[model samples]
Target: MQLQLQTLPKVLSVLVMEDRIDAASAIQFKERLRDLTQEGDQRVVLDLARVQFLDSSGLGAIVAVKKLLGPDRVLELSGLTPTVERVFRLTRMDTIFTIHLTHEAALSDVTGA
Candidate 1:
């Protein structure tokens, strides 16, 4: 997985460049997230536009990220493709995450724009 970490004024954006988040990359994903968010206080927006596939491990990895962040910070998901969105919805994970149509929207929400 190619991950880009961008720290904005009031949010940290994590752009996922891969098309799939399966068991193979799940551990790496979680580790990378831990590293990327170690020093941030702003909300985290995970960009999933390129992620067309998300398996059980991927979902578990995301949940682990949330736990890693703890209660004070939040992790929102943005730019989900249809297939990815379906997985979240089908698994009832949508309610756990704040889903946005675009990365800009998620940024604006966190920055209070």
Candidate 2:
């Protein structure tokens, strides 16, 4: 559950440094994200380039984070590996979130660049 948070003008980019998000780390993942995002109103971009695997629990945790963010702020995803992208697409979570091809793209979208 190693994650790095970078604060931008109107976005908080969380780079998921772990190679996998599974049942074992789901709870910790959710808690850490909650702690990191609690004080911000900025759009959240979860950079998952390094994440190669995501299980049901991990998916659930991500959805939970989106719900925690509420409707005002958005939870976007970027740099999904093919395997990770398949999970989101299969679960139809892709429609539930804005998926960017890269981390820079997510930031640019928020910054109007």
Model 2 over residues 1-113: C-alpha lDDT tens digits?
79988898788989999999999999999999999999968889999999999999999999999999898888999999999999999999999888999998888884422
Kindly report which residue stretches of model 1 are placed more than 4 angstroms away from their true locations once superposed: 110-113
Give me the displacement of residue 16 in model 1, in angstroms: 0.3
Going through the candidates in the order shown, the clash numbers are 0, 0
Give all candidates' CA lDDT scores. Answer: 0.90, 0.91
C-alpha-based local distance difference test score of model 1:
0.90
Candidate 2 weakest lDDT stretch, 10 residues: 104-113
- Candidate 2: pairs in clash: none
TM-score of each: 0.94, 0.95
Residue 15 Cα positional deviation in candidate 1, in Å, after optimal superposition: 0.4
